[model samples]
Each structure stands twice: as C-alpha cells, then as structure tokens.
Target: MKAVASDSAIVLVVDDSPESLGMLNIALNNAGLMVLVALNGAQALSIIERITPDVVLLDGIMPEMDGFDTCRAIKQKLPNIPVIFMTGLTDSEYVIKGFEVGGVDYVTKPIVPDEVLARIRVHTQNAKLTQSAQAALDYAGQYVFCVSNDGALEWATPHVHELVDSLNGDAPCAWEQIQQLLAPWLAQGDQSQPLELTNFEPPLQAYFAGEHGSNHLLVRLVTPKKTKTAEALQQELPLTKREAQVLYWVSFGKTNWEVAQILDMSPRTVNKHLEQVFKKMGVDNRTAAAAISIRILESDEEAVG
Candidate 1:
C-alpha cells in the first residue's frame, strides 16, 4: 500500500502518560503524518473542535474522562473519524467496551511502532475511500447524510441545504433542532433504534447506519411529490394560516428571527404570531409547541395514509 503524504493526514493522540504520547507522536510523525498530542481527554476535545483529524489514537485508561468517555464525545462531533484505543488490559470485556464506545481498533500497551502505523494506515485509507464516495454522492445531489447519536450533522451532501430549507421553511436546519429530536433515542443508550421524523414539510427519515468511525445514524430527507400545505394544517390544528406557518417552522426549531426572514415579516410580527400559537395550542414554551406541532403533522400523515 502507498504511504499517506505527511501533509495530507492529521492524527490526534490523547494519553495521560507523557511516555506513550511521545512515542506515538514520534512514530506517526516519522510515518509522514501530521501529529497532534493531548495530555487528557478534555484537551483532545478542545483541539478536535478546531481541527478534524483523519484518525485518533486514544489511550484507554486515564485519570479522568477515560478512553471510553473520550471516544463517545469524539463520536458525537466527528462521527466518521476513526478512533483506535490503546490499552494495557486485553480482557474481552474491556475490548468489547472499547468497541461499544466507538473504537474501530485497539493497540495493546507497550505498542509496537510498526503495528500502530500499520493499523493507522488501514483505518485512514478506509476513511479516505468512504469520504471520497460521500463526496461523489454530495456532488450528485444525494440526500444521504451521517448524523451522530447526538443528532450532530457529521457530514451531508451539498444538496441537503435545500431539503433542510424545505423542512425548516427556508431556514437552514439548525443543530439544536436535530439534537432535540434525537434526545429521546440517545437516552435509550445502545438499544436505541433507528429514529425517523416525518413531521416536517418534506418528511424526513433516519436509520442507524452501520458503525464505522463512530455509530453514525444515516438520515435521509424524504422529498414527496406534494408537501403538507399551511392551509391543510390550519384546518386540522386550532391555528390560523399564519399561525400554522409559524408552527411549521417552529417544529424544525426555527427561531422567531429566522421565521421572520422566511416569512418576510418583522421579528416582532413573528413573535406575535408565535405567542398566538402558544395561546391557541395552550402551550407555554417553544418546545411544547414544537412537540404538539409534530404530533399534529404525524396525525395528518396517518390520516392521509
């Protein structure tokens, strides 16, 4: 196999031990890979927020936020980035736990430089191939995207913006909305089934895509021939046409300012409509309004079906 270009790939190594970090850093740097080192999981997360690495070398045991927790956090953000665990314990339970927490592969303690490099190469190459395929899909305007268990958009096709806008009434699909929708499933832990939200304008569906770098849930924004019109919602829900429109956007977690821009109204006007929606729905908060709006939309779908 061809070696990756030193400048092409970045690797993050997180370990509490100075010796392990130093050794892995030198080995990876020598293998023509850019290396970033963190003394602990917190430091690793801070660095990851700024830079996306191709692969992560994580120490399984540390004083705080151990390897499993670190890997979980990483998967939440970068669901496609490969994580390899480095641990001294080789018990089956420990290994299983590693995989459970999103480790792609593991390297035993007293690491062999050559073995580590080989494993990194394999995972990194695989990641590149998957990303290349995803890029092709994106260019072809495919709606497939990978979201983390936390509902964070890890990667999506460029065409996704249009679907998101359609779902959110011309507003970009915000992370907060996605996370709110996924909160229920994520709370169920490992038994969480594939989640689907068909309450939007275009109606979206999500399935648990196979775990690769992380446990990524594949979300597909379904585009139907005809979407639920605001008039249809007004008749079913106790809301006026304008209030219904506001509810539609609210369902996708759109803010009053964003709804205002979408509806070509002032922010104050949007707020007034939302307040009316609250009164009509007997909901005090936006979250309740969104939840009620989703149930109404889902019921409408069932009726039509």
Candidate 2:
C-alpha cells in the first residue's frame, strides 16, 4: 500500500470569519495535520515569514489584503508551498485571478470537510514531489529556473538571481539575452544548450537543461567540464573527433538540427557521424549513446567533486 504523509504535514488556514477558521481547524487537526490559523492576510504573511508550511488554505475575501494579494506575497517568499484558495466567489474570473496569484486549487466557501481534505491531500502530494525533484537537482550540483512562454521569470533557485544580477545589472535584460541565445533551440524544442557567460572572470560555461511542462519551460543549470574538445572526448571513447563531438552534444539532448548549428555541419553530416558513433560504441540509438556518455561524465564529476 502507498503511504500518505499526515502527521508531519503543516497546513496554514488564512480566513477572517471565526466560524470558518474554527471548522477548518477542527477538521484538519482530526486528520493528524498540524493546523496554523491566521485571521487576515496580514497575519498570514507574518506567519509565512516565520515558518514554512507544506500547504496553505487561503480565504479569497478578507479585509486589508484579500486572498490574491496574500497569495502573491506568499509566492514571492515561498514559491514551492502550495496555496489552495477557499472562496465564496463563484465567478470564473475570480477563480482565474486566484490561479494567476499562485493558487494551486480552489475550494468554494461553506467548504465541505471531505472535499477540502481531498484537495489538500492532492496539492500537498504534488508539492512534495516538486520539492523532491528540486532537492535531487541540488544534490547533482545544478540550479533550476523556469520561465513562461512569454519569457517572464516564473521561478528560480535563490542563487540564480544573484548570478543573473552579477551577469547584468538588470535581470530583465539578462533574461532577454538568454532567451535570444536559446531562440534557435527553443524553436526546435531542444531541451539543453551551452550558455556562454561573458561577464565572469574565468568566463564560466553553463548548460541550460530545459524541459517543457504544461505552461512553463523548466530549466536546470549545470557548469559542465570545460573540456568539450572533440580530441579529448575521442581519447576517452573509441569514436572519431567528429563522432565524439556529435555524441557530446547528443548527451545534452540536442536534436540533430541543433547539433548541426553548434558544430557548423549539415544535419545529414551530423546524422552520418552519429551513425558511426553508434557502430563504434555498440549502441542501437542516440539515447543509448547519450546514456553511456552521461555515465562517463558523471563518473568524472564524482571523481573531481
């Protein structure tokens, strides 16, 4: 049987009505959840700054900062904590606004205990999965950032803002430059590309590893080993110089067309080189070749780290 986290979970309920707060508190506490209550938006923001909760149940209508404003403030401080809006507003526009302000799910007012519990369970589980993924990325020595289709910054690791600010004084400009740099790969749905950091003293070379989710482009940032020379890769593998280069880019999830752009070779030439690489490496496809290359690279990283 699958295990559900209950005892250690913390839920923050932000509402103005004493009745609503009392009902929610009683129900959530009975389920083995540690419940935190705030009478208004201001109080909720204060609580969030002090301690992080796993999930937040925010009331839509409140005095002096309403649900939308509070949720936005909460998102700015703790983006990973899921916010579920409990509102009497049945209008679709209000629901849309709730989502825009970073609400993960909505519960109509006069909340049903069972319904609210179910929604909380689902959103909390998702929040946990997201946290786990981010932790894995951190363990692997990478930072993550996500952007919307329009190139607006959605979320990023704390280190990312500092790095970006150092790169360019204006973060918007930096993001624009990155978007332009990745325009070609983005067109082809390529998930990873080498990023040139021009401002650093040593001129760090970072790779942008991206994956397209439902609405945003999720990216992982890693500083790869400086040696991408075909000669170096050829020395480690049985492949030729061009084959090694092709395999190196393939390991970063670049499509043949994108690889062609990077290597300044035609797509046909890249494919031809890949075929030879497969023959030498005894791999059936590009994915297998990439897997082998990644293993070798990760081994090198482990040895160095």
Model 1, runs deviating above 4 Å: 1-6, 141-305
**By TM-score, how accurate is candidate 1?**
0.45
- Model 2 clash pairs are none
Candidate number achieving the greatest TM-score relative to the actual structure: 2
Model 2 bad stretches (over 4 Å): 1-7, 141-304
lDDT of candidate 2 over 1-305, digit per residue (tens): 11233446789999999999999999999988889899998898888777678899999988889989999999998888899999999999999999999998998988999999999899988986686567546634435666655545666666666566666467778767766664554455544455555554334444545443334565555444554455556888998777888988899999999999999999999999998998999989999999988776555541111
**How much is the lDDT of residue 99 in candidate 1?**
97
Q: Note the clash tally of each candidate.
A: 1, 0
Per-residue CA lDDT of candidate 1, range 1-305, in tens? 12233445789999999998888888888878889899999999999888788899999999879989999999999888899999999998989999999899999999999999999889988987787566547544556666666767667666666556555664444445656876676557653454666666445555444442344556554433345656666887788888999889888889989989998999999899989988988889889988877776665342111
**Distance from true location, Cα of 270 in model 2, Å:** 55
In Å, residue 235's CA in model 2 sits off its true spot by 16
